[model samples]
Target: MLLISIIKTALELLVKLLELSNEGLHRLLSDAGFTEQRAKCQQRLADWLQGVARVLTQDGRQMTGSYAEGWANSMVQVNGRTAADSDIDWTVLAPGQEFHLRGGCERKGSCKDATPLQVKEGHAQVAVGAGSQPAVTATACGVRPAQDTCHAIECCSSFFKNRIRKLLPYNFDKVHLVRATRPSSTNELRVSFSFQEKDIMRNLSTDQGQLFTLIKFIFKRHLPLTLDTPGLKTYHAKTLLFFMLEKNDTHPSIEAWQPHNLIALLKESLDMMLSFIDSSSSPNECMPHFFMPDAPLYFKNAGIGGDFDNTKARVRDRLCELRSDISGVVEQLRGLVRPLQSEKFYFHPFTLLPLTAPPAVTEIRKGMYSPEMYYKFADVYSVVHQCVSELQSESSDRDTLMRQLSILQQLQWCKCATLCMTAMAHLKFGESEEAERLAMELQRHHVVSGLKPQDIQADKYDEPAKLPEDSDWAWRFCLPCDSPPRFPFLPEFTQTLFTARLSQPLSSHLYVNFRCLSWSLQAELLRNRAPAYAFDHWIKELLGDPDLEELLTLAHYSDCRWHVRLSLQQMEMIEKERRVAMETQDEENIGWVRQKWWRVSNRSGSGSDSGAHRSSEDEEEDEERRLWARARLGLVAMETAAEQRDSWTHTKVSWMRLQ
Candidate 1:
């Protein structure tokens, strides 16, 4: 009776420990910005997809994978700090999207009652309203085109060749082809069941969701397994989880998964994975796909047959080892939960930059360090700006601005941008003191250096390199091409980075641009109170900036020292045009000319097209056009014959005269 009592007490203690471990794991995940970061990553992909679809005239393309599933593990560590490994998976539909197959589709038994998330065959599925954003929204893709009627691979190739490839060096530059399959001689294709997977994933409870994240986190941190792991991909782990949940659904009232069962659940999952390996007698026998039980999820690559076998053998041994010391493993995982510390430094995974140190504006000015994360940061900045604009316009309460500022504050790497936005916000609120304070803060934004500079050499005209390997985290430097044209959606720098065939990293365009913006804000604040000559110090400093000369040398910057020069030139031109119109007393002409120049100047200053995908040649043509436009606006003569021959020059000048 005493032995029995002790056994029960020990079992209860074990359960309590597991529950505490689970809570600790949850805290760690939250601290690493998993929840918010995942959302932003998803939003980024969705926004990119929307932009791509609009450009391609294929409004049916939908983003998928971990991003769409809402369980993206953005906290995957590299060199002991979090980094984004979210490779966007999107399905590009062929023509005749809403058609039928010869026979109706048959779904898995578990998904029998579930709403058909994707259109497959004879039966049509429409998107039903859902509570959340992005995932629940579905578009009809009636059936896979019959092999006799349409060659899907050929269509994909042609689409890439004719439409997609033309946008090289800009949009779709970072895309990687993760999978391709030759199902049959006739039907070599690329397929995605993300829509079906999305339906299953959305039903996961909060505890289940955390468990999923915890597993992925464990794989990334400890086991160091990734999507590229042969026979034991992250997809297989996710599928295993789905199978476990579905199996447990038979007795729904009795929760099969609880926080207290964290270690047990992990052990069970490993045991399950081991079972698949042990039970499989041949290459043909493998772990079943969650949506299609007959289809093999593991060992799908016939070419990597030997590699898969070896990987499985290794994984099986590892799984057994893990299960044997599951408690110890749980303890190690629990150790990841550090004591809650104030967020003094937020490491931004997306940029791979730390936000710990205070601003060194002088270092940026003197060193002229080109920001490695600048373009990437600008992309995220555009998204945040849109959100800020939406909230600013919609919400009247002071709390809304504070809440937004608070969120930005948590993202410490974006110190300058945060300070810039806050200053603007305060300026809008008529708080000059606060605005000035933020401007001062912006001038002192945090910066870190001394790491080996990113190799700036890239050929924009060259075909984009293949996606970086699973182990390669420094992908930003691997394919440094022109920024995608999602312009005027939010403000971005006009000057383009010289990315092609670079011998070395250039001076800091990003920091220079930030400095320009800071000075502009300061000048605006002082426009009323301070003397006009008070701006002389700032003007002199900007004029003497070493990076100023380099900007003019860059092909894209064109006859301007910096953004401030371009902005000043643009404003002066607008005033000149306005004054001329006023002299004639032509109110209609005054409004029309003013509006036209403003749009033209903003387009020129933003340095990206109106979200259209363009080839290298097209990009060059646009660059020349911008140069001419800038010259025309500045009331200066064309310097070269090539500049004189710009096709846009005639049209723009003619339009200005007509207005």
Candidate 2:
């Protein structure tokens, strides 16, 4: 009895040791990021084992009484199957004796004797009668198919049997419960489920074990070392936060799940993204072929509009803050970099589609003058104009210039051009003074260059010149001068040229010939008379073409009609010259007279007697007397023809008939 008691005490101590080991293993595993519910699993298993052991001890001597005696009686029911009657018995069920009950088994001797049961292949018999009416046999039921199994034992037992199915000692073809042994020195517990390939695949498909595996891999193997790398800190933090948010829809789910050094890392990442956004050039600059107005709506829709005035106000405030920050950075950069003097710096304008006036302009106006800021605005206007010009040149399908002009007209630099064009448009409406004033202002700034009035007098000359009613002939005359006197000749010559060009077909050709002749005659005449006047007049006539009069008139309309008065004086001078040349009777003098007469006739077809008549008459009367008569007659005929053509032509013919 003492030896038996000692053995029992040793066994009890061994059981206690096992329980303590199980408890320590459970605690270690739980602390290792294992499921916390696993503690309840361990406690339940211990209770089950203890119940099995107590039942076995109580029924040890009653094996012959019923199928429930001894180990068979202590066999736990699993998944609705009695262990003794199950074909695939669990390892936890001990070998037991089979008992058969006869009919009316209230008599002790009526029941069959006990036989050692083959726990693997035996059946159980239950009493149903007093005599040996063949014992009511109950066939052993095969272990419930794994699919119908839900008990933790069944799951574990199936897992164990599958793992070592090919091994000899475990070749009973029955699932068995196996407990993992604790390592001798370690306090940590490792609980592993041996799942079949199909079970693993199913669990994976459902994402059941994925979260746990990821957590284990990250915390156990990846975290500390990954966090140690400074370069990866921000990236990993953002990734972790993104993943955490994705995993749980509820924000509270991640409230306790803090990544290592996450806050600092997130702040760094945000700063980096912001820096990238600010420093990167706008898409418009990078891709200029894209029309700014037609750029994606996302850029347009980025800010508030319409009734969201409050939101727009807040956005403007934020923009002001951002601008200030950027300005500080730019100043620092400028100080450090010291850009080349000729290098152009540009700022992109803030363009709002469906533009609303910005309120920040008021604040900006209060700052001290900055040349850089001034240039920035100027550059924006310039770039916009360049873009407008480019678009206009390339495409006729769109009115890009007009649209850009409309937008830019509000700006000061662009306003000049807009005002100039507006003035031109106003000119057609008879606001002549307004137009001229605006034009002058525009020209002063070099906004619009080289705009002057245009002469309307050419239109008046479209009809042919008409003779006065009392005139004997219709006469038009042009005096071609090489270099005429400034006071009298230059102005007359310019008027004749203008009139001839407007009324006569041979004006241009005659003007050239007369210029050469006039220069020779004037040089000779002034050789003994006013040389300075001659030189000055030569310059004036040479410089003043027909266009000069028209240009002056168009440009300065109120200027006097100097050209018309000069023409009358030139006619009188021609009469005087003819008379003086006649008395001289010099052929050279007559040649000058003939050339002048030709020019006059070519221009207006209204000059006096032809040079042929003057030469013939001078020869007939010893040259001098006949020349005088010819000169007098030429003068009279020139005046008559200048008056009217019909009577003059008839009178000349009648004189010829009389001769």
Candidate 3:
């Protein structure tokens, strides 16, 4: 009885600690606005890339990452986060657009007559005249003088006058790409399908995702000191998720997903590590590739078989946390047998899916990665629809209107805020001065709240988080906004990337592409809450394609689109009222119209006012302030890019093979 009491106390303490740890992690994760930061980083990177000439114009600029994937965890160190130790994974479309099958570098330790390109230093092959012509092997890339970094940039700029430029990753000082060559293989190049795995991960069941995440937490935190090393890649953990789910039996009920079952999940996952262990092979061996089973994950420094055995022993010794997480492990197995690990895998469950499905068809399909998003989005929309219905009523009470506005404010949805503020501004029939003041205040909070221009985060809207309406691949596979929505739940793919409630939960500020979002359609979006804003306008301008303004005309017939004529009619009436108020010198009437104009006009972040109280001097001062701020930002950008280039050049020279 005394022993039982002691055990119970220990268990209670463990649970309490786990709960607190979980809460603290949640708080830390929520506070880190990694999404915004990453978006800014990508934008800056993209902008700098544009300075690179044709590198920016190429099709493949993907912000593939944890923040982009909607799976960013608390610590960047553990989850590939951007806060502490972060790396940006930008998918660069090599300037040539076409993949040229090139000969692998000789592995003779040193080159005699030919230029020896060190594999460690990135070897980006650039095409010379055309596709048919032999490409220039741009290896041992460096400028002798440190100042020549600017010269190199200038040379590249002059070479490609009309070409689009590529962006560099801000987190990383320099771009790094490895074209892996096996010890003896000559013609073959091993290209890992990381994006393919990401797609598969996104499709994981909610329970599987939670289980994977928890195990990741344990792997990062409690792994024994001997076994924990950079040599053990996270890919091992990721591969285990899919491998287990492929064969691991699932309970018909939800019982398999309980926290108690999580231990069994981890134990089973750990036991599968045997698959990576080779009995008669070298002390170090590459992990089996889950994406391409034929090619395994080889590392330069994995040790001998006995060395791996020692690591396994160390890991088994450190199973105390794993045992603890279970909370109720018996002394020995009594009921059933534990499964033994397999030496080799011949089957992959991913291949069973129908292959004929088009890319567009595949997109509509999604795993239960974040099932909560659907419900949360529905709840937000329900509130928005209720508010819209109430506000439409001519006899709506002041208290009721305020209540609706309060609810909308609490949601912190820019869509609702835009709609509510617009209504308050244009409600010509009746609304007190207090309502107008409240509307302008919300708009003020929104505008001056540091919403960056459409350019910064505009690149983000074109990733997996978003898909073109179809695979509307125009301008070398750029997914246009007008791409139709493929997923039923994701009805807004054509315009908005992530709907307000469905996207990452942010409180401080929300950044949106106002190019797609017009002020006139603010109320329509609030009423419908679907991603119906057409991307034609934004896409056409960006790609230099002819404007598809013709399709937008058809949008009016649909319930989802804004009635432009009706909106214009309402604006005309307001303009007449403002003109008449100005002629009569009605200050009270002028004050209300002035606030309305501020709501619409000040959307550009200028904070301009045309009221009687306004002065020309203030506008001039604001303009000067903006100009100074921009000049400073530009100078900083140039200095930072130059520093990055110099650092990259230095690293290359150190790691390079001289001609």
TM-score on alpha carbons, each prediction: 0.41, 0.13, 0.33
2 against 3, candidate with superior lDDT = 3
lDDT of 1 at 635: 33
Per-residue lDDT of candidate 1, residues 406-478 (tens digit)? 5545444445555665675665566778877775564445333111111111223121211111211221111
lDDT (tens digit, per residue) of candidate 3 on 194-275: 4444444444444455456545544543352323633344456666665666555333245554444555666677666544
> What's the residue-level lDDT of 92 in candidate 2?
25
Best by lDDT: 1
- lDDT against the true structure, per candidate, is 0.39, 0.26, 0.32
Candidate 1 lDDT score relative to the true structure? 0.39
By how many angstroms RMSD does model 3 differ from the true structure? Answer: 23.4
Where does candidate 1 have its weakest 10-residue lDDT segment? Answer: 140-149
Number of residue pairs clashing in candidate 2, backbone atoms closer than 3 angstroms, sequence gap of 3 or more or interchain: 16
What does the lDDT read for residue 118 in candidate 3? 28
